[model samples]
Target: MLKKFAKQTLVAVSLAVSIPVFAASYTIGTGSQSGTYYPLGGILAKIWSENIDDFDMRAEVTAASVENTIKVATGKQLVGIAQGNVVLQANEGVKPFPRKMDVSVLFALYPNAVQFMVPADSDIHSISDLKGKRISLGAPGSGTRVSSVNILSTLGINESDVKPQSLNYTATTNALANGQIDAGVIVGSLGVGAITELALTRNIRILSFSEDDMQKIIAANPSYQPLEAPAETYKNVPAFTTPAVWNVLVVNKNMPQEQAYEMTKVAFDNMKKIRQVVGVTKFTTLENMNKLSGIALHPGAQQYLDEQMKK
Candidate 1:
């Protein structure tokens, strides 16, 4: 009986040694729970956890783009989702960014269409109309707010000219629905939850940028690319052309090349799975990788892209 018990213990030990253990669980800092970044981060984390060999990634709710830049640069997060313009600002030590950040781009996600929305029946019809009207420009110091200010100023509407309300996407939408605010800015991917919810019962119109308006916005900041939101993107919303900033995935530049390469490859390989849930993620492809500017791609990411060239 003693020999048989010893034999079973030895077999159990061998089996345990043979099984692969998850090396580490990393955190990907994403935006608020109601925004696009959060869900996209969640989807990527789930895909990585399942597809990667002995690795797991979890998503953490964050204040979004601006905070994500600092988190990844400070080593507080392994990965993060941030707006492309914010990334450029962080790289260049622009306002809201104290100094140049040390980071690397992993992939370009999607565009955050800077959607200026107001009640459909409201007389507001142009960016200039926002003057003296209450506007919610995301949370204070957020990427969305940065875009709002940049665009407004480029279009000749200064912050002092408008009542700027610093609120999150959810609160901004709620405020608009409740008539507490005159206009709101939602800088997010198509079908952002807050806007989707508000559009369900409230008649909201997404203000679009005219051709000249877009040209000026982009000239001031090349990070702002123009995109059109399709009518089907949200209920009662029409297809409108607007200036957008690309959303991107990033990692600390210090991450080892092999790890970064592996992570980048894994994400692109499994991007189809991501697209299944979020159709907009279809932009997360090798073809769209050039969307980023002023930020260097990690060596590992470049290596992976090179490898794809061979394929």
Candidate 2:
């Protein structure tokens, strides 16, 4: 009986040793829970975890673009989602970033439309009217804040001229609904949940940028492009034009090229599944990959793009 028990113990040890373990684990830094970045990161994580052999991934909620860039640059996280303009600024050592960050883009994901929202009955009419008004320019270290600053500067409005409030999308919406803030800027894809929810309870006006204003903004910051919010995107709201920036997926430059290549492949292969989770399919395409300018591509990403071009 002792020999038989010993034999069974030896067999269990051997089986445990033979079982395969995950080769590596990675974390993806995403934006707030209410935004697109978090849900999109979850989808990508699912795809990578399932398709990449012996690999594991986790998506972490972060403060969005600027913070994500800093984390990925410092190697605190393996990958992150950030706006193209923020990535460019980080690479160039611009404000909010202490020094240049060595990061590379995996691919362009989607366009983040800058939505300036206020109560319908508010007297504020245009970007100029925002002067002297209490405005929530988005949370600190967020892409929305960076874009808002540019827009204000281009319009010749300084930060001191307006009462600036730092708040996230959800908080900004709540503040606006409660009349704590005169207006707020939200940077996200069309039909953002927070903005939609605010529209449901309160009539909101989406401020539009004039043609010259758009041109001035683009001239001051080439990262921004003109985009339009379609009619009926928000309840009872009409179409309006605004400045937009592309959101990109980035990884540390130190990440292995082969791993990045595999990740890119897996992302494209599971694009359909990703779309089922987030309705921003129109922006996630091979052709849109070219839209990712100003940011350098990871070697693995470049290799994948080259292969696609050859095909």
Candidate 3:
């Protein structure tokens, strides 16, 4: 009887030791391989995976916000980088979100200035002025595509009005410089390398939003905020002023609250260091974070904020 009891105990111990413990890992869906968001996402993945033992993390090159939100909603992605206003629209079943999506905001990341580029001598001067011209709206299912359509729709312009080319930022820049496309639209902070490089080698103008355009977009969506990108943001360009937008970090609703909580803490704790990462300058502060995130904060992120408040 004693030998049998010992054997049963040993078998139970062996079973426990042999069964694998599942370790949680998260994937952040960013943008195209060549874009600023990808590298920034990789930086986040490194920080989360290396410093935080609670969860494993990595960044994936994806179609950006519009698709990223859908991915998060459907459980294909654990986290996503999204445009702020777009996130609100997604949750409300507007624009890119054909149905309401099930993702929550972790925090606002950075300003995504609405940058319009045209040849130095082009006749295109404003949003409405681009009528009958060739433009790159970005690849289908991308955040840039959704935002471009939204802004153009507000201006009473449709895909038919311009030769809309679906291309990524790198492709758009090349097309613009080569005179293949008259204009390209980008959404990100000023000083992003692609824009800076384009500006340095060519005469490019960043279009401004007229008061009418601002009013129309804001009236259509209240989450839209008026922003300004100062001049000389890139080499050889004089200080220029224009209206802009922002981006947010989102997480799946089904993500483990414990992992989300720790990830958020790690993000805020290391946000200062995150700024040093490429294309992350505008996302370095809690204030900016609060201003740009549109969705309801996740419980995990809220917990971190709560702890911050107590301090």
Q: What is the C-alpha lDDT of each candidate?
A: 0.88, 0.89, 0.79
Better of 1 and 2 by TM-score: 2
Cα deviation of 33, candidate 3, in Å: 3.1
lDDT measured at residue 128 in model 1 versus the true structure, 0 to 100: 82
* Ten-residue region with minimum lDDT total, candidate 3: 235-244
Better of 1 and 3 by TM-score: 1
Residues 1-80, candidate 1, lDDT per residue (tens digit)? 99999999999999999987756878999988888888888998998888777788899988888888899999999999
Q: Candidate 2 versus the native: TM-score?
A: 0.93
TM-score of each: 0.91, 0.93, 0.89
Could you tell me which 10 consecutive residues in candidate 2 have the lowest summed lDDT? 287-296
Top candidate on lDDT is 2
**Per-residue lDDT of candidate 3, residues 1-311 (tens digit):** 99999999999999999998765777889997667778888888888887876557789888788888888889988888878777788788876678888878887777777777888788987888889999999888787888888889877999899889998888999999999999998877667777888887898887778778888887876666677666677755555445466677877766677867888888777767677776455555665556654466888777777778787
Best by TM-score: 2
- After TM-score superposition, the amount by which residue 277's alpha carbon in candidate 2 deviates from its true location, in angstroms, is 1.0
Candidate 1, superposed: residue stretches over 4 Å from native: 1-22
